[model samples]
Target: MGEGNWARVKIILRSPASRLKGVCADARFSGPVGRPAVAPVLCINGPEDKLFRSQSADITLSSEKERIKKMLSEGSICEMNLEVELFALQDSNAKLVAALHEANANVEQWKKQLSAYQEETDRLRDQVADLETHGGHGPSDLLKDELTQSLEELESLLKAKDEEIHILQSKKSEYHELERDRGEAIHRLQELEMRNMDLERRVQNAEQTLASSLEERDRAENEVHRVIDILDVKIFDLNDLRQSLAKLIDK
Candidate 1:
């Protein structure tokens, strides 16, 4: 058993035994037979004395029984307290165990990360060694310088190309605007041409109407001249008839 449990057991046994010893002492003092007198002879003479002694013995016995009961109750309370403490300790131990498990899991994760880092470090070292073996130190330095110069040239070219692209984009916008203006001018020219065709057609129709009017005017003038000549001949005939009539009258 654990030290705490053992101590609790000892306490449980000790209290009851001590109280029993006190009870035994009381029983011995209350005995009426086979025991020596503890008081003076003059003090134990008559019926009153016997009654008093009996009452004293009864009181002592009752007090001893009560003490024994109290001791048993105290022992039971101690046992209950110990049990409560044991449960509390068990709960604490379970919590500690859980915490330890969590800590172990964290440690394992860190170890994995550390291992991956170590592998990366080894790879880098190997790459450095390979680079060293492939070329002498001066060659590596020259290669580094060449790579840096190439990068700078590439960057400069990219910047120049970007500027060219910007200029082209601006020119493209201007071309688009010019194209739109040309389309508008073409549309206006088409409208003017249509208007000119309509005006030409109107002039042609007016000329045809004017020709028909001229032909009708000539026909009317010729009919008028023929009528005037016929009138002149009739007048001359009437004058001749008048002269013939005058000669007959004279006869």
Candidate 2:
């Protein structure tokens, strides 16, 4: 965890065989000569966010240079904590889909019940007609009351079912929209991850190239210094020979 200006971390990695610094650059070591090639940086400002639970610390990274320095000094991290959070988000999305499916199933069941009620109403009407045809008289008070009561009850039940369907439909639509938004979010995350991977690879390549260039430059400079020293020595010998020839001529 990043406490103050410096962060605390534990990592295990072997130093590259080509490393100029023969000693392993682990956290236990000290100074520029013993620094590790790679160090993990605890990101104070993560893009996705909610990774760390931090108390209010007033560590200000106010400049872009500072941010870059921090990023380079200690490389980025992709941790178990972040993965667990993403998995939780995915699980929540799945539960939402399941709930939507259940609501849709409920809607279908309500439609079936509604159809059954209509069929029953038709059957009652047919019975009423058949009795009227046989008796050629009006319906009995008890029969009229019962038929009216049944129709009224059916109407109320249908209204309630309609309201339920409306509510379910609204909820289903909401879930679908949420699913679409989540799909977009996942797509964005995939693109960002790919870009980050590409950038990290490029950075590694750049560092290798830079180190090689610096080594070559230093070798060239050393050769130049050796050549200059040799030329100076020859010049000194030439001056001594000129003085000897002058003395011989004078004698």
Candidate 3:
């Protein structure tokens, strides 16, 4: 049987055996329970040299008149204070033992809770890493929209450049036919030079457009890095919280 239940039995059954039954020592129940159980401690007033000849721990207070106390002469109701003191010691011991058992159980429960918290924290960290990988270093909606806008702009510029390249090739073909009509004339030579100048200008514009597109790509990369840093900090916070809770549980 549980020690708590055993203690309760002793308290309930002690009434028929002694002047007063043993009391429950539960501090939590003390408001409803008035007194601690009174018990007898055998202090042999005999010679110390013979102390170990016999050691008796059990005592039974049979009735108001014929009760037995270990340390007291059998029929002597010597001191009220001594009787009260003995009972208090027994009650204190019972209460303390019960408290220790409760504390041990509580510690085990705390350990389980701490373990669960650590597992959850680890899972959240893994999720954060996955998000950083797929979310382009940033998981926020604003960053996502910015990246999308940049991609659209780059695609538009690329399509426009493709059309310009096509137009340039057609112009070059037309210029080649014009060259065929030339007859060692200065007008034809000047026209050819103007066509060459147009081609060079197109090349320069294409380079400038490519440079702007590269800048957009770099900005997008920076935003992604910034978001990754944010996730790292949040992960650290989660770990710290888990540790703190674990420490509390240990205590």
Measured by TM-score, the strongest candidate is 2
TM-score to native of every candidate shown: 0.39, 0.52, 0.26
Candidate 3 C-alpha lDDT tens digits along 1-251: 56776665455445553212112122112333222243222233332213222111111112211221222332122334334544555565456556556655755665575566556555655655677998777456754565556556556655765675576566556545444433233344455455556545555555555455455545554555565555445444444443443354354
* CA deviation > 4 Å runs, candidate 2: 1-89, 217-251
Predicted structure 3: lDDT: 0.46
Each model's Cα RMSD: 77.9, 23.6, 54.5
Error of 2 at 163 (Å): 1.5
lDDT (C-alpha) at residue 6 in model 1:
62
* Candidate 1 local lDDT, 1-251, one digit each (tens): 46776665456435875445434434434433233344212221343344454455556555555655555555555556555555555565556556556655755665575566556556655655677788654336655565556556556655765675576566556556555555555555555555556555554554555455445445544554555455344433433333333343344
Worst 10 residues of 2 by lDDT: 52-61
What tens digits encode model 2's per-residue C-alpha lDDT throughout 1-251?
13431221111112243132223222223442322344323222332132111111112212333454455444334323345555766777788778878878987887898788888878778878888999998777877887898799899988898888888778778777767766765665566566556656655665555555455545554555565455445444444443443354354
**Could you say which candidate leads in lDDT?**
2
> Which of candidates 1 and 3 is the stronger one according to TM-score?
1
| Clash count, predicted structure 1 | 0
